[model samples]
Target: SQQGEEDPQALSIQEGENATMNCSYKTSINNLQWYRQNSGRGLVHLILIRSNEREKHSGRLRVTLDTSKKSSSLLITASRAADTASYFCATPISNFGNEKLTFGTGTRLTIIP
Candidate 1:
């Protein structure tokens, strides 16, 4: 089964404000990955943090993982209007079948001008 669910199906904030989102999963996993997709563009890998790790950062983005609680969080600091995009959490699934990842529905983030 898939292992993660992001909170707040949608979010809106003025440009330059930080945006925060949460994710919760249901099963044990090898790793967690985050992605961003802009309209008409393909999903882009944002960052990847292994299960053995707790937190990771990339540029203005910060991510935290809690194995015990089966949850993760992503934070985009000083967000810009151009930062508007859909964010998704990917939990690595078992080798069962050929499935490599189970992606959550995702959170729609809108950065207001």
Candidate 2:
């Protein structure tokens, strides 16, 4: 499957704590992106890391990519209850102008106050 696998399917943490999620893929990819979905509804794009990039940071989020190992990790620092959601890693599928995003098995996070 082109879709990757995310570890620790679920996590529960206290507010202000840090949350981390890991993903591993099987094949080569041009880029990797992370998203958050609330209540199984809309997805909010968080970060994108290209194959050439080893790491990136945005606000409270940090993303790391290791193409050599075909793995990625997302870290959310000082998480809040509002951060509770299901997070997914996505890669692209393309063919002759046709492109689609394929998502990995997601990690559900719950933050308690």
Candidate 3:
């Protein structure tokens, strides 16, 4: 039931600038993941960081997690016009015998040319 929520409902920036997004969750999670979705397209998994991990990076994407604060942040460096998309944070929910993943509302990022 709505585990995470992303900050900055929407973001706009120039092509060469950097973009940063944040997420906060209500309950404990085993892992947190980031995803990107282009307009009218499906999502692409970006990175996943375990609860024990503080930070992780893949290519131009960097993610940091703070379990104590129940928050996570995603940073995209050297943003390009093609980077315009919606980013979301996801967390797994385990209750009784039902287990599934819940996604945050998402942050819409627009990279201007």
Candidate 4:
């Protein structure tokens, strides 16, 4: 399926701490994206790191992609209670001329205050 699978299905950390999650995929991809969902809310795009790029940062969020390992990692520094959410990693799959995103098994993160 080439779908990514996130490790540590669930995680809990104190506020102001850092949170990290890992995602592993079965096949090669051009880029990977991270998304966050807060409870009943929809998924919000966090970051995207391309295969050619080793690392990228957006605000307090840092994303790293290792093409050789077929894996990616997401880091949220100084996490807050508001950061509590389910995080998913997505990879694009091309079928014919169309492209769609396939998501990973999410990691539920709880930031304790």
Candidates 2 and 3 compared: the better one by TM-score is 2
Of the candidates numbered 1 and 2, which has the greater lDDT value?
A: 2
Model 1 ranges off by over 4 Å: 96-99
- Residue 52, candidate 4: Cα error in Å is 0.3
Estimate the TM-score of every prediction.
0.93, 0.96, 0.95, 0.97
lDDT of each: 0.90, 0.95, 0.94, 0.94
Worst 10 residues of 4 by lDDT: 1-10
Alpha-carbon runs more than 4 Å astray in model 2? none
Give the C-alpha lDDT of model 4.
Answer: 0.94
Specify the poorest-scoring 10-residue window by lDDT in model 2: 92-101
Write model 3 residue lDDT over 15-95, tens digit each, in one string.
Answer: 989999999999888899999999969999999999999999999999999999999999999999999999999999886
**Sequence-dependent TM-score of model 2:** 0.96
Alpha carbon RMSD to native, model 3? 1.1
The digit string of per-residue lDDT tens for model 2 on 28-93 reads: 889999999999899999999999999999999999999999999999999999999999999987
> Model 1, 42: alpha-carbon shift in Å?
1.3
Q: Is candidate 2 or candidate 4 better by lDDT?
A: 2
**Considering TM-score, which of the candidate structures 1 and 3 is the better prediction for this target?**
3
